[model samples]
Target: MISAPHKSSGKTLVSLGVMYNLVQEGFSVNSFKKGPDYIDPMWHRLVTGSQCRNLDPFLMGAGNCLDSFISNSDEKSFSLIEGNHGLHDGMDVDGADSSAGLAELLETPVVLVVDSQKMNRGAAAIVKGMQSMPPKACIKGVILNRLQGARQEEKQRSAIERFCGVPVLGAIPKDDALAITERQLGLTTIDETADAETIIRNVGEKIASCCDLQAIRSLFSQAPPLKTSQVKAERKAIASVSIGVFMDPAFCFYYPENLEALAKNGAELVFINALEDASLPDVDGLYLGGGFPESFLRELSGNRSLLRDVREAARSGIPLYAECGGLIYLCSAAHYEGETYPLANVFPFEMGFQNKPVGHGYLDMKSVCDSPWFAKGERIRAHEFHYSKPFDSSEIDAYQFEVLRGFGVTGKRDGVLRGNLFASFAHLHAVANPGWARRFVALASDYKVKGRCAV
Candidate 1:
């Protein structure tokens, strides 16, 4: 397992670089993400040319972690598990539920990615504490990132090795070329980023030069043999349906597993851009994932043609599903910075930016209304992270459909679902709730077959 002291220490780049170099060296490598991140795994998949699965112990349980890891290992000789946030960062008191805890549970060896630019000997202290803390947390080696130069790199490397008693597996130089463009959600999705292949190759070259690729590969060989199973249950034939997926840079938050699940359950996906595209694709359903739509509110709002097209489609009974940024886009108006912009207006609501109402963390959703997304009384676990809040309570009340877990937007209420539109602030991973994609596809299938919305 690879972990960092904090976010943006080049963990993903280092992991992907190492994986790509290994694949180039003639090794069939598999990759797994530690938490609910969908963006990093896209780079992993691009580098390794394999489907990367997420292993969140909190959401999917410890058993599913091992299951997901083992199942994806069927076609590869080695597996790389990239962790999220900091090493010991988690949602529990005392950091007991952190990624380090999960590493201990899985008995996996961790390589610490330390940002060596700011600290000389202090970096060593952090590494030593991580290595010595709870000996059960098997931190094997350290990778010194953001090295200034040869002299600075040598000083930091020697300091870490001498003080921390851990081998410096790598020392990555400060290279602006290796930096990936990022917005609110995370790194720009591979699909939207230009020259993706060149970027990956450049990153891989830098990582290979700095890191001990051979040592990293050796660690993967130490992973215990994984077990596997197969279910022969026949897949139900889903009626023909097409789903319009928001794919522009502003709204590109989606789990690959989610899209795969929808396809596997028999729904064709049509990609559309919210920034440049003028109309939604001809489809039975529309899916608007999450991204930094607020930053592009002016551009999105100015695209009157696209906004009108989406509103018309929703009115025509097209099943529309949106999350976070997507939810904001469907609102009647969105207030950002100091200006207000008219949105799709599919839902009778307006959103305003707020400093105190920033929503974050895991959520449990309970369905209050029978909608195409979920059956009445169904409970689903999802993550919610945003800074905007609904401004008009009366308007929100007109379309409110689901309630959250005893918080924000009281008893039996959170998401806004009206007619064929299901919009929510919470973002979901299909693996967390395997039934979501199927239900979405089923609804779309119903609309396609009958020429009318399912709900």
Candidate 2:
């Protein structure tokens, strides 16, 4: 496990570098990221050439987290898990849901990445504090990042080893070339970055030159063998149904498990490039996940044919679902940077952006009314992070979800229901909401059989 004392401590970049280096060494590395994040996992996927699964203790529970880790780690040469935020940071006061807790649960030793930008001796103090903290993760080694010179490196390395009793595996000099660019939503998607592979390759080369590969690889041996659980596939409801997914630069925030679950529950996913595709494919249902749609306003707005096709599909009562960025694209118009652009116009409200997040954090919501996707009175544990909101907040009164915690569209309700369309700012995970995939496929099947107005 790769972790740090706090966020922005170079843990993510270090984790990616380690994965890249290991993959270059002819090892089939399976990587996992803690918490609900799409950006970091995308970088991991790019480096390892495999889908990086998320292990969120808050959403998936401890049992399911174990199951997912074991199921995905089969027949792999190595497995690397990246921690989010600080090692001991979490919503729980006892630190039960922190990355350290996850390390303990998986029985994996953590490699701490300390940013040595300011002080040398202070780095060891932070390490000592983390080592003695409750739910202390078994930190086997430390990597000093953003170092200045040999004097600073020697001091930090000696202090950490002597005081904290942990090996200093590496000391990386401060280099701006290794930094990844960021936007409002975190690191920009790999699709949007033209030199993404080049960046990963450079990072891998640098880390390989600095870090001790042998010592780091030995940490994998320290982890006890996890008890494997039997992963049973959900029973297929229908033979098959086609589900169109927007998967371009504009709308690429999708969980791998969600796509896998859809396929497992008798849905053949038809991936569509919203920016390039002229029109929608022949599919029973459509899914639009969260992404940076605001960045491609002109390009998306210029695609009139595709926009009309999507608007027509909504009007015809096709089972369409959209999340944060998807919700933005479905709006009649979007105002960003003093410019307005037309979109699919599935809904009547105008979308507007803000300097800060309108709703950011784990979301707790209950179904207020029955929709094609959810039943009334059913509770859902999901998450939402969005900077955009509708201009007419009153339109959210007819939404499906009653917000129990965290801000929703109207600060009270979410899950906008119109015809057979269910759009929301909340992003659902298949593992947390196990019935989502089956229900989506079943709805699509019903629509296929009953034609327009099937819901």
Per residue, candidate 1 scores C-alpha lDDT tens digits across 38-112 of 788888888888888888876776665666666566544777888899887777655545778778766777898
User: Candidate 2, residues 101-212: lDDT per residue as tens digits?
Assistant: 9998999999999989989787899999999997879999999999999999999999999999999998999999899998877788898899999998888888889999
- Model 1 alpha-carbon drift over 4 Å, by segment: 75-77, 93-97, 105-107, 132-135, 148-165, 175-177, 191-199, 227-239, 354-357, 368-370, 375-377, 398-413, 453-455
- State the local distance difference test value for candidate 1: 0.78
lDDT values for all models: 0.78, 0.89
For model 2, how many clashes?
Answer: 0
**Residue-level error in angstroms, candidate 1, position 313:** 2.9
The true-versus-predicted C-alpha distance at residue 286 of model 2, in Å, is 0.6
* Candidate that scores best on TM-score: 2
Q: TM-score for model 2?
A: 0.97
